[model samples]
Target: MSLGILVAVGGVEFEPSLLRVAEAADIYVVRRCVDVADLLATAASGQAQVAVVSAQLRGLDAEVVAQLADSAVAVVGVTADTLSADEALLRRLGISSVEASDDVSAMAEAIREAVREPVRSQPEFGENGPGEAATSAEEGTPPGRIIAVWGPTGAPGRSVVSLSLSAELARLGAPTLLIDADVYGGSIAPMLGILDESSGLLAAARAANLGALDAAGLAVHARQIAANLQVLTGLPRADRWTEVKAVLFRTLLAVARRAHAFTVIDCGFNLELDEEISYDTAAPRRNGATLEALGSADVVVVVGAADPVGLTRLIRGVNEVMAAVPGMVPHVLVNRARSGLGWSAQEVTQMVVRATGLATVRLLPDDPAACDRALVHGQTLSECAPDAKLTRSFSALAADIAGVPALHARRRSRLGRT
Candidate 1:
């Protein structure tokens, strides 16, 4: 069998020997990687069978190794100083074995073995996947439902809806955790009267990077706002995206899902991809956390304002999400819905239905007084405006997420006489 290999070993002295030996061993060199990032991008394409990478490769960690292995690419580390440095640290990352680059015999054997070994048959959400049995069993909670609340760049109330939905879910007796995953700018803590400067998401990310974040560790960082509601604050500054890596962010969200019945993320607005495409460096995308949340979410709530410009943005944003994310049923919510704009809800409904082809649409009435009051007091809309129409709308959202019927649904049922 012709084994495809991507070589990114350290030092120029080893490159010629690796290339020559790989050819001698019947291995076909698919790509010669310049750095760890290059190796990872190539490996994820599912073409390469094995990666002979350097043990001292910068940014080489368990998560990176796991991602490569997930793509069915077994990693083999080649190092000149394997005798001095402990191999145990790298072993945990699924490296088949570490061999001295000078020892051509051992290096060839390791590469050959990795190429011949059958890739493990595992689901995408393996033991570490979101809400998998291996993790939920330990947490003692029901399989959690993940909801990602996203909007466009104009700030159409993503945080408010996220917080109110979480609060209402907790009020309905489901343990809920609200995550401020807005890598652009997070306002969940200050909106909820949380004064703690410590960021729960950042702390969780650090622990996840070290492979130390678990259910108990997650529980410790989560700030309890109510009996069944918890909040994980986001980055205090937009520049703190460096602290939260994408892989670690996914792991943190998975752990959070295991610990709660419902995990609602107040996601950021941007969905643009990093276009630089570097072979030697990992370009930082400010919206990595947002993308991660959307990819993992079981349900996504797309919110927009009811005005002309807002609706236009809403339609464009929905199309972007539909084109970008697959396997998700998006629910579009037209917030601040009223008749002052000379277009009725019925007309707006038709426009959205024609534009996005989504059947699930909700119209939340425009109520500035109640929303402003809730924002000023740092309380959930359900708390300060108990009898407000907007609060009722948010409660309807929570009930829908919980798979239960609310007054709105009941009223609609009565009207339809179904």
Candidate 2:
């Protein structure tokens, strides 16, 4: 089997000797990408199994690397400039194989090596020795469980569920931090009536990248909503996802988990690893936070609307997430499961189980008034509408997640208009 290489080196750097060396190694130069767009297009055409790209090429960021990987195209970065920063940037962007030598033979060898090390769906956690702890930090505390609340597009109750769940966990006396990780339009600030525009996520990201983030530094970024509930708002604009890198974001998550008893990430809708156009536009995908959050999560709560159309999207969304990371199957949460849409909770539950092959589903009733009150008051369900069935359900979820008996019995109440 001949390995095809898409060469994207500068025209000046593409010396005749480079071609001769690659061809000798049985690496056929099938295409020469002029830019990032052409590189992606060529890779998508299946003409290339490996990309021998110039590291100085424009639009070569982590997202670009990921899109190339999505096409199963291995990337071998060739740069004569062996600066440490450039190499670190490439690795962070998911490029593992890089040739720093100026020789054409080195480029050929790098392409061959990358072909042998293809990307795969990674496990949630990395390989560690038996009996070894996940973190050996000075803080000898078991980190809190990080639960990422995600859903499909079209405003499925992601924020509401995230807020209520975190609030309930805090109310149960577990130290909780509610993170608004929505890379698109984050409504956590307005919903909670916290008028501050300083996104804690960005602060944490900046600190994490600088290696200055710790428990106390993180505290400065959070808003103490209640005794045990803290809020970290998300991006001020939808286009600001570029501020967060996957590796740096992962570091922030570790600090948050260690600092709290429960850290809940209110994630965005998109899960796509979007193909990039250029290095200028090679910002992190809008759902970089969501994917990283999911990958880092101990549990994932996927909320979907319960109407017929909603259920269909939910099924597909769940399947897509499962396909992305087969190791972590999310807990399905069917929001608006009440009868207003002419579907019973039991029927929706059965449909979810059958269609998604998921073993369980949690139902949250359609209570517009209860949800409104919480939003209006900028308070959690437990605080705003304590007796509402929605509040009761959130509390129950919190209990199960915290692994403690609930302050109130788990209410398997009917989906009735209150």
State each model's CA lDDT, in order.
0.76, 0.75
What tens digits encode model 2's per-residue C-alpha lDDT throughout 248-303? 57767777777788999998888887645433433445566788899889988889
**Model 1's TM-score against the true structure:** 0.74
lDDT of 1 by residue, 65-116 (tens): 6567667887787766676443434443335477776777777778789767
Cα deviation of 149, candidate 1, in Å: 0.7
Task: Give the poorly placed runs of model 1, Cα more than 4 Å off.
Answer: 1-60, 63-73, 76-142, 276-282, 407-418
Task: Give the runs in model 2 whose Cα sits over 4 Å from its true position.
Answer: 1-138, 276-283, 407-418
* TM-score to native of every candidate shown: 0.74, 0.66
Against the correct fold, how does model 2 do in TM-score? 0.66
The best candidate by lDDT is 1
Error of 1 at 62 (Å): 3.8
In candidate 2, position 247 carries an lDDT of 61
Give the CA lDDT, 0 to 100, for residue 79 in model 1: 65
